[model samples]
Target: MTATTTGGLPVALLLPGQGSQHPRMATGLYSGEAAEPEFAAAMDEVFTAMGAAGKPLRADWFAERPTVPVDHVTRSQPLIFAVDYALARLVMSRGVRPAALLGHSVGEMAAAVLAGVFTLPDATALVLDRVRRLADAPPGGMLAVAAAPGELEPYLGDDVVVGAVNAPRQTVLAGPEAPLEKTGQALRDALFTCRRVPSLTGFHSPMLEPACRGAEELFASVPVRAPRITIHSAYTAGPLTHGDVANPAYWARHPVAPVLFWPALDALLSTGDHILIETGPGDGLSRLARRHPRVRAGTSKVLPLRATEHGP
Candidate 1:
């Protein structure tokens, strides 16, 4: 069942982070008429684990309009994680073996679990704790900047940090709201587009230090193991070592660390002309991957399963 391929090219699964979630994003995957048995069962396992952990997921993911807005990190994170993994299972059930896995931000939870680094329950527990800590962090803002990391460097101070480098020109900045706005204004002045991200707290920056600490404490109790599949680390921007995957300290660094998506994508493309599939809801990651020079130069194709028709 794992031999499925479009053109004999190995497949790489790309999982999106928070901002990619939308209302009823899993509707197509879980509708009675379309539901795959493995997807449904995987969701059941997630729900059961959530219930037993006493941190029951309350959002109606199938709602025509999600009761929990996309900006609300607490409800959004676990829901997105659940849906992403369920969708990934559905894809695999169809015989698409993921030769490698790359996930952005919270999406890494699904990648980690699927890679056999942790059980569903342990991952759910970790997600719950991580969300709690992020909720406790000081309020901040994030902006998507259409400029290179070097061009944006002069604008960064103690309050500003590069949150993510999604592509060569697409970088995300996180910090206080005022600083973010100021930086955006500066970018606009320089003829670069800068849009505010729909998030209440700035993640992947020093602002999350306290939250990172709490995450470390939570991860200490959860068992970590070597991954059965290849998982490109957004933190390290390359393949993860068994020691890196098994260390709680390494996992803890993810929250406060900048997501090195550009370098990681470079590393993945350097391997070969691989097929890149966004295993989750939105095609944001896929779109970014398409912009990579290697993907454009090589014969690789990028497909996003159940992705929104239009995305950033």
Candidate 2:
């Protein structure tokens, strides 16, 4: 980790979660004529780690048309995991390694795999199991709201809850499809600027409780080791410790807890000037990180690894 602190600025890899990767996002990146050697090789390694379950994933990703919607949780999280992991690998291939990793949402699991907290196979199993458990969960979506979480409190409930705190005003509300739609319309009526977050289920809310409860035991069998690379957790808004992984409850909180990305990022940048590289396809996180005073003051930086981000 010390080796990556170039010129007193350690490179920090930002792992993105679900909303960062869309369906068909990986279609042309690592397969067919558009295949990139480093990326393709890394993706191949991911597929191999996933074993037989990865076939459909590769097929749907590379297919001109897919059997299931690419945004389905069954495929999206795993796909995001694949793209994020490969993108990080591609960047590392260029000899720029990260001293620390910070995962946003589903990206947290990806960072664990990259940080050696979980072996590839172990992380793959946990991801696949999560996908399976949530496959039948109530269909839901997310709304990006241009308001503080407190200002939006009246609209939140057991159904609709704060999903991500990307910034002071850049909050996302997620819940079941019907409730979310109702809340979106309510926000619109109240004249709040908002947009839809594509392909996201009821993330960071109680709406996912059933699924989370069903698979709460999955992590018990998956061994957790201390991270080789430092990891700043979104949940704790600080560095992760053995306490966070002492039980399976922490992992189970993923789908049902708010993503405190901004707070975690605040803690990260507060430590020192660092290069925050978005090791994913989009610049969503980069956009948020750039709003920080450190980056705004030119003391820190944010770069997108793959600007090949697809739009909804």
The C-alpha stretches of model 2 lying farther than 4 A from their native spots are 1-6, 32-34, 308-312
Model 1: pairs clashing at backbone N, Cα or C within 3 Å: none
User: Model 2 RMSD to the real structure?
Assistant: 2.9
In terms of lDDT, the best-performing candidate is: 2
Question: Per-residue lDDT for 1-312 in model 1, tens only?
Answer: 354365688988888887777666665555466656777677777877887533335345655565556567776788778877887887787687888889898878899999999999999888877887788888787889888889888889867899999998899999876777787888898888888876887878888886677567778888888888899988888998788877888877777788988898889878987888887777789889989886787688888875432220
Report per-prediction Cα RMSD to one decimal.
2.9, 2.9
Report residue 312 deviation for candidate 2 (angstroms): 24
* Model 1 misplaced regions, further than 4 Å: 1-6, 52-58, 64-67, 307-312
C-alpha lDDT (0 to 100) for residue 264 of candidate 2: 95
True-vs-predicted CA distance for residue 15, candidate 1, Å? 0.8
